[model samples]
Target: MTLTPNEILALPKVVLHDHLDGGLRPSTLIELAAEIGHELPSTDPDELARIFSDNADAGDLVRYLEAFAHTTAVMQSADNLRRIAREAVVDLAADGVIYAELRYAPEQHVAGGLTLQQVVEAVQDGIEDGVSEALEAGHAIRAAAILDAMRHLDRSLEIAQLALDNRGRCCVAFDIAGPELGFPPAHHREAFQLLRENHMPVTIHAGEADGAASVGEALGLGSARRIGHGVRIHEDIDGFGTDEVSYGVIAQHALDQQIPLECCPTSNVQTGAAPSIADHPMHELRDLGFAVTINTDNRLVSGVTMSSEFGVLVEAGWTKEDLFEATLAAAWGAFLPYDERADLAESVIEGYGIDL
Candidate 1:
């Protein structure tokens, strides 16, 4: 049966690349800005939402990123961070996301006199409250934290240590997120080394604004088990067709190592990584044996939901079986323990009424 939009929304989903500061509700943004005496482009929630969507659709990575300034500006205080985080979970649950790992840079939230640790704690508390409320509402949802360090900054090691210190408590993994062109994964080698020494999992933002070289550095130098938006790995493929598609070193390595690529369709299109959903490389990558998983990089900024992402893919010629496979891949690629991941995968398979 062809899956309708509502059917897709009702299906259990998994998300790995969502951003905390990038997914604030438009109404919440306006209210927070008012509390902090910050000026916004528009006071009307609908107009504010349009502004965010339009700014992010600029087709330039740098300009697309400018929209975050408004969202992060309102997320400085502990109360604001907590409220945003909690609401993020509630929102995800409503969209049928059973599991998610929301990432945010703690250093960005400390501008209002809050310490790094304080921001983490506040977000964690909010996540707990969100999970509890979702359960009360009969929506089973679970979320974990992934602490990201800005790649252009010098506090990567500090943030890595923070992630390790809170391992198994709130934080699940360490990530480096920011401008990926100039600041390659090698710039944060010390942080990666710290994570490696502590046996912590790491995911790097690569191959979005850059090329396959960035992805190679992420895997080899940074030891990333997963690549955030590794869409540019397409650049490394030698032959496009003719029965023998040759993979370059980076592409071959990613496929051979079974590293997961968190593919955010709408976000990638908005950032010009792909021209549109039809032109996305995820379908090719998946066919080539790369472990590709779907995600919502930013629900509000990209103006998407997990269900909407699935709908786009389906319109682009994907099948219900393809969506099921992507969800299963996300479950296995999650930062959870082996048993937990296995259980989640099993549940997803059952939810899809399919045998693995």
Candidate 2:
């Protein structure tokens, strides 16, 4: 059965690819920008929200990423960072997200003279505050940080060290996020190697702006435990919709390994990664034995909540069982211990009211 919007909102969810800088509340954005005299496209919260959504709908990854400058501009201070991080958790919890991994580049937040370590600490403080407040409000949500390093920069090794130092404190994984073209994951092999030696989990943004080869580099070079926005893996398939489907070497490898794909359908459509929700490859990939998990890559920028994302999928022919399987896959793919993952799986199964 197709799930209604309210039912979708009540369903327990897990998000592994959310961006902290891209999910700020519109009112908070205006207020933070005002505090620092930063000019915005619109000062009114509603108008500002529309402006962000419209700007990000440019149908190109480079153009879509232009919206982040404004949000990151206002996030240069510890107070602002903490406030945004807290609100992100509270908002996700209100939307029924039981577990979320909010990611952002610490290097991007140091423009105001804060150290990378300071930025991580501030965000962690906010996450703790958000968790306590959400629990008090009758929502039980657990949030963790995934520190990202921009692929276009030269500080990935340093950022990887930062993530390592903050492990178990707040950071759970390290990632590289930026334009997937021109800059391949191999360029940051040193950083990835450092993370590997430290036994830290890594997720790479690939197969979104680029093609399946980029995904191959993420697995082979970066040793990514999860692929962010891997919708482009369809490029390696010979035929998609018929019994004649055949997977390429890379696609076959991913399927054989069951590596999780953090599929963000709305953001993918906006960035021209997918034509539309009706034609997204998430269901097909899942059917073909790939571990596909749904996520909100950027909530405010994409103008979506977890519930709205699932609602759109249901409209596009996904069933309630589809949501359950995807959510379960997300739990299994989370950067937690096996015992923790099992507990999360149990929570999801209980929430869905299904025997699995």
Highest-lDDT candidate: 2
Q: What is the C-alpha lDDT of each candidate?
A: 0.91, 0.92
Show where candidate 1 strays beyond 4 Å.
none
* Candidate 2 wrong stretches, greater than 4 Å: 60-63
Which digits, one per residue and each the tens of the lDDT, describe model 2 over residues 1-356? 76777899999999999999999999999998898898988889998888778877866556567669889999999999999999999999999999999999999999999999999999999999999999999999999999999998899999999999999987999999988899998889999999999999999999998999999999888999899999899889999867789999889988888899999999999988888899898878988889999999999888989999999999988888888999999999999999999999999999999876
Give candidate 1's total backbone clashes: 0
Tens-digit lDDT track of model 1 for 1-356: 67887899889999999999889999999999998888988999999888777878877666677668889998888899989999999999999999999999999998899999999999999999999988898889999999999999999999999999898877999999988889987788889998999999999999998989999999999999999999999889987433578888889999888899999999999987777899799988887878999999988888888999999999988998899988999999999999999999988998889865
Query: RMSD per prediction, one decimal?
Result: 1.1, 1.0
Error of 1 at 289 (Å): 1.7
Which residue pairs clash in candidate 2? none
